[model samples]
Target: MTEFDILVVGEANPDLLLRGDVRPRFGQEEQLLTAADLVLGGSAAITAVGCATLGLRTALLAAVGDDFFGALVRDQLTTAGVRLMPYAAGGVPTGVTVILSEPDDRAMLTLPGTIAALRPQDVTDALIQSTRHVHVSALYLQPGLAGGLAEVFKRARSLGRTTSLDTNWDPSGAWASLDDILAHTDVFLPNAAELSAVTGAANPDTAAAQLVALGTTVVMKDGARGARAWWPDGEAAAPGRPVDVVDTTGAGDSFNAGFLAGRLGGHDLPESLRWATVAGSLSTRAAGGTAAQATRADLMP
Candidate 1:
């Protein structure tokens, strides 16, 4: 057995969430009608925390500056039982995200900060060889790291470790190197829009097929509608579990964590999806991104 169940590679940051009725215009300001909170975020933060909460022996490889935000991030990860490796330079500032959410929707403004410093050298071979699953996240934003990251995944595959990817955001939608990354990805998780953007597919089925053609197992997430997985064996659809949603920020991460947890525990694809949907639904009941993330007790089966 591997020493760690999952190793997440990405960026870590602090997030400021303003909840309730308050809107900020381009040139105008607004008054707060609700409350605000400071919490941990970034793709790696949410995914690693979710994995740990789901009873996985999780390890995180991310860059964090030598500033206040970085300190807080380290402390929070430590409290969450995530093993962290040093990856940032001294004196740099950690990344941050400012989120404004109303009763029905939310918008965000993110500063990459030290997150931009994350490079391929930060992903050590020992770490890759030690984990059962190695997940690479937020590829689009770190174009510089993408190529090298691909090499790491390729090496991990050669070592027999399962590889997964979460292409979190693609603001530009240009995937000049996406195929290279997918070639080494055993599992590829992308939201509907991101799938369309990456595969240029008019619909979900085509997009999923396109990803599988690139040699990856596709897990396509469609908000509200549900999620599906496609591989050489064909496709399996998993309906979304209904819930009283409070926030949707960490839903996807929680879903991934739950799915991986189920897989590690020898569950079938459908069973994994069921656990994933439940975990995602549970994550919406709190304030921050991972606020409602479920533990082993919350995810029975």
Candidate 2:
């Protein structure tokens, strides 16, 4: 048997969620009104937690420091049943994202310590060959790995393991250098905004068409309305699951987990999309991403 059902290679960090009037002011103004929480963050870490919750044998390979936050991250991952591998990196402190959150939206200030420390070489050929699937996230945040991810994906493909990418948002606005990676990527997961930005095709429909032409299955995550997926031959969609909103910190990452776990577990496209939408919607019921993540029982008919 394979050592892992899925291997997630990306950033791992913690999020400090601050609620209430989060609008910051200058001159060191003192402002407070609500609650604060420190929770497991990072796209890869959250997704791994979700996958494990859904009963996948998940493992995470990411860099972090030997600091308190890193220890917290490792502890949370362990508690969530995700196998943490090679957790420490030298020189940098562990990364953290301070999320100033409202129910529907949020702003984040990030300290990219070991977040940017993951390199392509860290994902060895042995690691790729040991897993049934490979999933990567937060592409723009890890330039070292982002620069060489296409090669890594190529290796994964060559070994017969499937691959996926959730590039997240490209902060530079350029949205360049992804065509090569997408060529080797079997599944391309992006939000509508990220889809539009990456493909520059005016709207989601056009962007999905453009990307499917590159031989990638585009799964566009549209909040509230739902998510849609397009393969080269056909298309499918799933409506959003309505829920009481809390924080939207890691909903997208959870959606990724739902879709991936569904498909890997042999569900069809429409069913997988249902898994994704439900997982995404339910995740917002808590302060941080993984707090309210869906379980396999929660996802069943």
Task: Check candidate 2 and list the clashing pairs.
Answer: none
Pick the lDDT winner: 2
Q: How far is candidate 2 from the true structure (C-alpha RMSD, Å)?
A: 0.9
- lDDT of candidates 1 onward, in order: 0.82, 0.92
Residue 218, candidate 2: Cα error in Å is 0.5
> How does model 1 fare in lDDT?
0.82
Q: After superposition, how far is residue 275 of candidate 1 from its true place, in Å?
A: 1.3
Task: Predict model 2's lDDT versus the native.
Answer: 0.92
Q: Backbone clashes in each candidate structure, one number apiece? A: 0, 0
